[model samples]
Target: MQGLMQDWPLTVDKILDHAKAWHGGREIVSRSVEGPIVRTTYAEIHERAKRVSNALLGLGILPGDRVATLAWNTGRHIEAWYGIMGMGAVCHTLNPRLFAEQLVYIINHADDRIIITDLTFVPVLASIRDQIPGVKHIIVLSDEAHLDGSLPGALAYETLVENASADISWGGFDENTAAGLCYTSGTTGNPKGVLYSHRSNFLHTLVTMGSDVLGIKATDTVLPVVPMFHANAWGLTFSAPAVGAKLVMPGPKLDGASVHELLETEGVTFSAAVPTVWQMLLTHLRTSKGTLSTLKRVVIGGSAVPEAIVRGFRDEYGVDVTHAWGMTETSPLGTQATPNYAISQMDAEQQLQFKLKQGRAPLGIELKLVDDDDKPLPHDGTTFGRLKVAGPFVVGEYFRAEGGKILDQDGFFDTGDVATLDEHGVMQITDRAKDVIKSGGEWISSIEIENIAAGHPKAELAAVIGVVHPKWDERPLLLVKLKTGEAATKDEFLQFLDGKIAKWWMPDDVVFVDEIPLGATGKIDKKLIRERMKDYVLPPAAGVASGAVALAAPPEPKIYAPEPEPEPVVEPGHEDDAWLHWTPDAAQSVDRSRREAPAAPADHVEAPADAQLPFRGR
Candidate 1:
């Protein structure tokens, strides 16, 4: 027997309808491109989104066509988001930070028919105009005054919407149809697209609204410092409205002072950003000594959250920091930092330790760890293993690539991260599978070393890579970008790592650089470092004690060559025989005086069919 409840599918229209009906008076604030805060209500926004949709239809946009947006987080951007999605046209948010060539490639590849962008990006788009063949209609999200004379045949955003009828009907369509498309950060290669369906987006929003995840509520004011181009801003776009929460969008200025001013003025209760932004905010707060009394909590992710950042927020500012973990394919949020009842009253430091973990899997998302042979790893958090995840929001395949062939046979997506889950079910990331240091027979987590090094007072940023060491197969080389006006002795920094890690995990040497290279997606670029330090030679142990200088050409090791015939693919429940090769380097010796590297014994843990991998450092 079916229940009497309505079986209507959850779509952007439904979310907007609910927001307009129940929370019509709630504020949706944004900083206009001209530099002032404008406050509007959800009811007004609902009407404008409908008008924008009608305008799209007027311009001959059919369902499933890609509509590109190159605007910042503002009222107009939000309208464009819902307008395209509501019409069943996939909204492709283009990152302005990407290179001109990449921008041209993505726009042309997606066959974007209409592009809604701000005036600021006009210059860049103009430079690559002739290259983008798919883009036909360009709508500037500003008035004529802001428009430059060089932009030919572009319609103003207001002019298009003002004449559009607000009564455009949303013809029924399957919720499984595509609604949005977000490209990866392209750290290693050209960016791949993650196509999100309406069903996936709707489910992701419900999970985000849970009390354990973002816990969005109508009374809360959310400011997503993460850009819309980044995994749909961790899927907060829908979560904010699904729960009727007030949203404050900061336009272009994301600096500490500007962001802080917006947070204070808007009375923002919750916000989310990466560690770098929080660090800058913490520094500004320390210098200004101003209190963020209204700010209640901050969700830090995209990168690992330092202990100092967590402690500073809780102890100093009275704001709880939730260290979340997810990826572009996971609808951006897989794990939250909320603790269970048992650990709620634990000591502040102990609770922080628990909070530091990747928390637990959000509702409807499953996490598990697996070995090289596809066997399940335990949740003991001691055994580190590769992380695999699957959920409603998780992408099964890349858009327009290989005809949906990205998933393994078991339907799990490899997150490319190595991690372990503790007894408390909190996931701790060790390193990326490609970056995990293999010394002798053990794996050394470079993230642990980098995190510790970053905690040092003098260190601004740190990256640990397995450089060519003649003795231990591979030894860690520390690359540091020091804080301005801070002085740190190499010996002192080494001493700081003494008790925190194993002696074998100690870096062979510390190299100072003007700046640590960062990828387009804001993560540290270890690939560049490995290339720059390709010819570096390690100092002999005997030379360290004698202060004698002896430089020699680095030994060339045998490179592993793959067989012409590929190995057979193993199904999830099947086992295949494969041999892994390991050899120790002969030139570098482990510094016993240094700290011992911590073992990720949990790397060996595995999960069930729908299990998630306990990986970290995403």
Candidate 2:
């Protein structure tokens, strides 16, 4: 027998309704694509969103119909999201960064009826209008005056809300009804849709607001630099409103200058974005001598956070950097690297090491690792395996059952990532399952190598791909893109990795290029790298031929081989203990020493600025 409780459905509309009633005056600032900043409160947005619901219904949008939105993170876009989901319609967010053909394919796949888009995307939508026959009407997220003649027969967004009634009912349907659709970046194949339910979204928003997660509070001002189309901007759109935190949406212009301007002008306290975007911001801050006085925390994900970025934010700027890990399939928040009580007791360097790994799973999520045979692996932190997750927010299957059954019999979904979870509950991603290098029956993590190479002062970007080797079966090839005015030789990089990593794990060769390929989601496109380097040949080593087999058995299980020599023993209460510990200064010293003799120039090729590279996985 269960205790009696209210049977209130956990619909997405309740989040807005509660915010409107309790925090109606909270501010929502947006950088408009129409050359102005628009400001509105939760109460005002709530009323306008209701009108949007009525307007959509008038356009024959049924409860289960999918309404696509090709827009940025603006006040109007937020209103469109609530308006579409509130009326039980599915909100399908289209990424503008994707190719035109990809957009057409997604639109056709979703069979969207009404598309609400920003003014900037009007021309793009117009170009593909003829191909997407399912789109019945196009609504421009602008005033009637801003509607271009080229977008024939499009309705103005403001006119719809201004002419509609604000009095409308919401949430009469089941909580499990589909509320939104977000497609993966389609690195491996055609983009697949992850249909999110109202229940899942509501649960996800709740978890993100918890102290151990995004830790959003009403007193905070959030700037989600991550695009709204990317996994619901990592779920900030819903969490911000649910907690009544002020929002500052940076639309269209995601460059360093624009982001810095908003962060300072709007008094942003917390923000989230990928590493590349943060790199630009850090560069801007250093060049301009700007300070992040108000900014407190930053969530870096979509790709691994570089060690330099973490140090720059934490050591130099006094800002907290949270290394988050997730994908579109997990409502985009599977794990976050927020410090815990156990971590607080450690030294600063130890804490940084722990924080560098993806933090523990929050209360609502369950994580596990398994070997190739689907057997459960121990949470020993050293044995890397395929990462699997199950939670209220994780996807059970793709939209329209595209990939068939995705979850195992035990209900856990494979994350397509290989990782290890320590006894302290911290999880660290070693590599993507397909990207891991198998050399002599042992695995080498490409991500670990790339991170170390990217941490170098002269290396602007780095990617590691496995090449064919006759002896070892596969060997890693290091690709590097130097800074604008910086240079480094292959020997310099190899020497830099001497004590930091195992000798056996070193790259067989280094090839310098002008730029490394980045995927649509701003991740290294290894698939394209492999295709480009398919014909690459490795140079001969000391004794083994380039293709000769070196070993028959895999080494004992270890993430990285032990250091060549053990540290000297220190007496009790000795001063050398402090020096022996890994400190930021020591790390910088090592980096500086490596650059002292780097005058040798290496042969490098330059690719055209507008190279037409294929987009690959996230």
Candidate 3:
């Protein structure tokens, strides 16, 4: 017999509808683009979204039409997110951080018909507006005050909503229809769009709510330091309201002091951002000698969170940091490091190490470590392999690409991450497979080396990239970006790294730079680093063909060693089934629902908003 709960169609509108029906009173506060905390309830958001949806339909936006949003994280931006998706039109969030030419490419590539932007970004849009031919309407999310009768063909955000009715109908959308599009920051090449379906988005929010994961609740005032243009602000925009959590958006003020003031004043309970943002926040808090008490949990992803950061937040402020792993294709939330009971029993240092890992897959995700040949490896945590996953929330293909087959034979998305899974099923990403440095035929994790380097008292941030080495094939070159006014000599920094990591793993040399370049998504742009320093000389190979810089052949025919097959086990029922794909074991049943449960830890404490602490909840 089949279960009563058959497959029910899901859409972003339904997510908003539920918020309005049940948690309508919940607040969504934002530091408006114009400067001020603009607050509104979920009920208001639902109505406005409806109005916006009606307005889009009036604009002749058809199903699957791409409505672009070039705005910051604000109330109006959130409205545009739901408004476009609710109408069955795809909401393509354009990352303003990307270069102008790339922005033009994305807008034209996606064939954006209409664009909704903020007052601050008008100049940027104006500069590139003529380049994108398909854009028909440009709606500015502001009032007439900012309008100089300039910007031809641009409409005001209020004008459209004011004329449109809020009683529009929904329930016409199929869950498979595209709901949103987010491009990967093109550090290596042109940015590619990861088209997200309504079902994938809805399920991602559910997984986001897991107590040990993003764990958001109605009473919490959440802030996404990550930009809305980047992976839906890591899905916090939708996930926040899905659970009725008030979203506190930091508009243009993302500087240390500004973010600090907002977090303290707004009583933000939970926050999410990349490591770069946290490093700045931590530096500000330390310099200011501020105290954070009410802050309960923080989700740190995008790049690996340095061990120092994990230690600082937990030991100094008591804020639990959950490390997550995902990509634009995964609705941005995949594995989460929720320190299970076994790891929690370890000492503070050991626990911190565990917390530094990518953690286990959320409920809906199926994670596996695969060898170069696509054969699965063990969950022993020692075997490093490429990571692949599939779930309800993970994207299967790119937007409108021909023959767009993105998944493997059995349907798992290769995440391009090289990682290991512990016996507890926790996955720790050592580095990107492409970034792993092979020295003397053995792989060295640049991420590990960099994380250790970040622990140096003088180093503010560190990036390790594999540079050319004649003998070793590839050797690590450490690029150190010191904090403002901080100083550390090369000898001192090298000494600090000396007993912390393996001798073979130590960087051959250290180079200090004014600053590290950041890609569009705010992550370190390693590709640019390599390109910038490509001319550096390398030491001779030990035993390879010549002493000169000898490059290892790219993973080809004779590169990877095969794993021994598992002995055949006599099953109680049938042992006649021949083993198919060589995995450590049969694919663990993939469940698409784990991505939906709230994964925040229960220990999150909330205090009154007016508390004097730097990290208190309102």
Candidate 4:
């Protein structure tokens, strides 16, 4: 028998309604793209959002219609987001940093009718306006004063909203209605859309607000340096409003000075951004001798958080750095590195070591690792395998079914990340599946070496890629982008990693580049790095010219034949039905050092018969 409960639909509109009702006086400050600091409260934003809905309705936007926004993180962007999502319309966010051709492709693929953009992106949008035939109206997120009449027939956002009525109703439809659409970075091929539902978004916000995850409270001030177009700014858009937290939008000025100015001026307590942004901020702080007194905690993701970044923030600024991990597929919040009980008990060095890992999966998410043949790997913290995740917010299929059958038969989506899950539920990403180096039939994590190299003071950015070697088939080649006015030789860097990693895992040669190529998401573009270094000739020490260097070949990993795929099981009230079962035998006591490359553990603990247990959050 099912327990009776109220049937209140979990729509995105309720979040704003609740915020307006209770925290109406809370400030939502923004550094506008028009060169001014704009301040508005929840009550005012709520009213404006309603007007946005009415304006969209007047513009002929209907339920499930796609309304795109190619604007920065600002007050107007927030209003447009809620207005579109609350009115049963899909808010498709366009990343301005993407290539013009890519933006054109995504806008056309999404079939967005009306696009609301900031003045900064007007030129970019106007150039491709003719290419996107589906786009009916271009609503500039500025007043008539800023309008230079560059694009013909463009409407001003203020005029449209000011003319609309605020009495429009919201949330009469089902909670499962599509609310947002975000395209992937398309690093490999064409980008695929990840259509999010109101249910999934609302649930993700709830889970993020939990103490184990982001733990954003009403008293905290959040600065999302990450763009709203990038996976919903890592879900800060929903979680901040849901908890009545004050939001400080950085707008388009994401430079170290601008971000630091806003953080100091606005008294921001908590922030989330990629590692590159933080690196810039740290550089600015050090050069300017500035202090971050107001900033308390920061969540760093998008790429792995370098050890130097964590130490810089923690030791220098006295700020806690939480290394997070996610992708476009898992509502972009698969795991957060908040200290658990066991990790908190460790000493300072050990704690930093634990914090360096990607941390554990929070509640509402399940994680597992598998081998080449899809066989489950033990959670011994040593055996690295392919990472997979299943959750309510995880995408079962891409938008419009672009990539057919994304999820495995057992309901877990392969993340294309190589990772290791510890016994305490912590997960550490070693390398991307395509980026892992295969040397002498053994795998070497390029990411692991890159992280170590990046920690060096001389290195501004580092990337590791596998280059063909005569004896080992493949060997890691280190690429370094030295900091400004910093100089380092290949021998110096190799000496830094002498005792840090295994001798066999050492890079063959080091090459210095002026700048490292970063993708649209601020991640090191290894694919592009490979292309740039495709014809690069390794030094003689790499054994490319002569097979003089003799290295011992590691034992080949066990290969298992593919097994029959299991069918997905979906049951009512049983969220763990989609989770892979892990028995007690799967637990192994192995002290694995993730920092240094070490030999694989000798003993293996095989998983026993599948005994499913109810999913629990640590």
**Cα lDDT of model 4 by residue, 438-459, tens digit:** 8999889898899899999888
- Name model 3 segments beyond 4 Å from true: 4-7, 402-404, 538-618
lDDT for 173 (candidate 2):
95
TM-score of 1: 0.86
Clash pairs, model 4 backbone: none
Q: Candidate 2 on 1-618: residue-level lDDT in tens?
A: 997999999999999999999999999999898878889999999999999999999999999899999887898999999999999999999876566677888999999999999888787888889999999999999998897698999999999999999999999899999999988877667889999999999999999999999999999999988877888888899999999999999877676778899999999999988777788888889889998879999988877777888999898899999888888888888888877788888888898887777778887799989999999999898898999999999899999898899999899999898889988889898888999999999999898888888888888778898999999999988777676676566777777767877788999877665446565566776775675556667877732222211110111111111123233233344332211122211111111111221111111111000000000114
Model 3, CA-based lDDT: 0.73
Predicted structure 1: clash tally: 37
Give one digit per residue, the lDDT tens place, for model 3 in 1-618: 978896679887888898899999888888887766898888998899889999999998998999999887888888888999988999998866555677788899999999998877687778777798899999999876777656787898988888999998865868989999987665445677888988888888888887877888888989888777767777788888888887888876666677788888888899887776777778878999987756788888777788888888888888888888777778777878887778878887787777888788878999878898989799897888998889887777777672368799978988777889999888888887778988998888888888888888777667889988767899998777665566555566678888988888878776665445544455555665675567765434321111111111111111111122233233343233221111221111111111221111111000001000010000
The list of candidate 4 runs beyond 4 A from truth reads: 542-618
lDDT of 1 by residue, 179-227 (tens): 9987765555666788898889889888889998889788899998776
- Candidate 4 positional error at 239, Å: 1.1
Regions of model 2 farther than 4 Å from truth: 541-617
- Itemize residue pairs with steric clashes in candidate 2: 187-616, 187-617, 470-547, 471-547, 471-548, 471-549
lDDT of candidate 2 at residue 273, scale 0 to 100 = 82
Error of 3 at 29 (Å): 0.9
TM-scores of all candidate predictions against the true structure: 0.86, 0.87, 0.85, 0.87
